[model samples]
Target: MNSGRLTNFLIPLLAVLLGVIAGSIVMVISGYDPIAGYSALLYGAFGDSYYIGETIRQMTPYILSGLAVAFAFRTGLFNIGVEGQLIVGWLAAVWVGVAFELPKFIHLPLAILAAALAGALWALIPGFLKARFKVHEVIVTIMMNYIALHVTNAIIRFVLSDKSYKSEEIHESASLRSEFLQSITDYSTLHYGIIIALIAAVIMWFLLEKTTKGYELRAVGFNQHASHYAGMNVSNNIVLAMVISGAFAGVAGAMEGLGTFANISVKAGFTGVGFDGIAVALLGGNNAFGIILSALLFGALKVGALEMPSSAGVPTELVDIVIALIIFFVASSYLIRLLLTRVKKEGK
Candidate 1:
């Protein structure tokens, strides 16, 4: 890689290393063996085919959600409402899946499309508000999260559910589960959603890096006044960016509803996946391939953490501490850059 690319890669890598070190310190302070804890964690995530399958399954949504946050970041929009978008998308996808009867090809795509459109429409509200009324997206998105949660819950209870806390299971035709994958992975929940997530990543990369519209969006992000003066429609680009970001988040919800769960439950609280996406995007440096790798790391950490208490006599919560430390280091990257600069100067 070139110098710039190398630096970009090194920053996050070093942050991860530092976070690991800090976590080990915390484990020691807590009277646990960090080595054993981490070993168990790793084994739980990748030591067996079953674990590997689960890790990949967990990674699917992380990839899409990371893409959602990263897309908005690229366009100078803070889409804190990905959680809301994902919730509504999940509801829409499950509603379509349960309410429809069609061939697999048609049914599946239609459900996924419903999710995307739901997310897009939900996001359009904040986008429009920001574009037309100069409202800050952050406040609107945060409130929208609560709205999405309650609205989805109400929909499940009153409209989609048979007086239950969850919607009916989706039809088989709308499912993303693959028998071949299940058999190979010891019947884990891994599904074809990974393929969709990968494809979405590619699309984001192409849309943001290799297109005229992408350039215009980036330019608006860099300087909206300049972009407007240069004859770009700044307001429209803002709305488009949020819509696309919401679509990615919506697909993330579909990965959960159609692939992992096959139904939508009335949530008592947020799923946390959307919030975690912010950390994923930050750790990934908002790059497409970087987000994939970052999501993989997070997925493994989460899956592996489940084994810590059982195998190493460590609390599962330690993993959360480690993850927080990692994000802290990533967020403090300015210090890391300074350290790198010092090292280079000393070497020279």
Candidate 2:
């Protein structure tokens, strides 16, 4: 590969290696066996069909959430409000699933569509503010997360559930759960959401790499003033970017509601999936295929962490620390790149 591509690939790999090393150090200091811990983790995540199925299930949402963040990054927008968009999308999806009854073909797509629209509308607030008023998106999205949490919770209690903590179970027609997938994977919660996630990835790749509008979005991201001078509609592009980003996040929520849980519950706090998407996007270099790989790595780590406590006598929380370290290294990749450049110069 060319030097640029090589560097792009090496950065995330190096970050993962450093994070693993750092995690091993922590394990040793904590009186745990790092090899045993990691072995158990691997076995837990991929030892059998069941674990593999579960890992794929977990990866479903991670992929979409990563896409959500990556898409906004490509368009010069920081969509920190993915969490809020996801929550509203989840609520909207579940409401449609519960409130409607129709053929499987229509009901399922309708619910998913509702989720995408809800997320788009939620994201539109900050997008419009950024485009029209020149307001910063970071602050608005952060506040909107809290708004989504409480508002969804209240709606579930009063409107959807008749003062219950969760909404009614969705109709079978609206479910994404697949009997064939479940049976093949030893009845694991694997669903058809993975298909949607993969399709979304392809869509992002095509939109960002193959289309004229994609060129405009990336150009705007690189230099808005130049893009405007080139006759691009920078304002509309900004809003459109956020809308597309939110749509991705909303589908992520639908994976949970219509596939994993088959309903929505009152969440006391954020799901953290949206926040994790930020790290996923960063580690993936905001690339589509890279995001899928990173999401799988994260999914394996999470699923394997559950096995660590039982088999290796390690705390599952250690995996969280490792993830944090990975993100830290990724965020500090400028230093890593500088070091690599110096090494190359010295070698020459």
RMSD of each: 1.6, 1.3
Worst 10 residues of 1 by lDDT: 325-334
- Candidate 1's residue-wise lDDT over 92-111, tens digit each? 99999999999999999999
- The global C-alpha lDDT for each of the candidates, from Candidate 1 onward, is 0.93, 0.91
Q: Which stretches of candidate 2 lie over 4 Å from their true place?
A: 345-348
Encode model 2's per-residue lDDT on 1-348: one tens digit a residue: 999999999988998888888888988998999999889989999999999999999999999999999999998888888888889999999999999999999999999999999999999999999999999999999999999999999999999988989899999999999999999999999999999999999999999999999999999999999999999999999999999999999999999999999999999899988998887888888999999998998888778778988999887677667657766776676688889999999999
lDDT of 1: 0.93
Cα displacement (angstroms), candidate 1, residue 91, comes to 0.6
Measured by lDDT, the strongest candidate is 1
Off by over 4 Å in 1: 338-348
Clashing pairs in 2: none
Collision count for each candidate, in order: 0, 0
Best by TM-score: 2
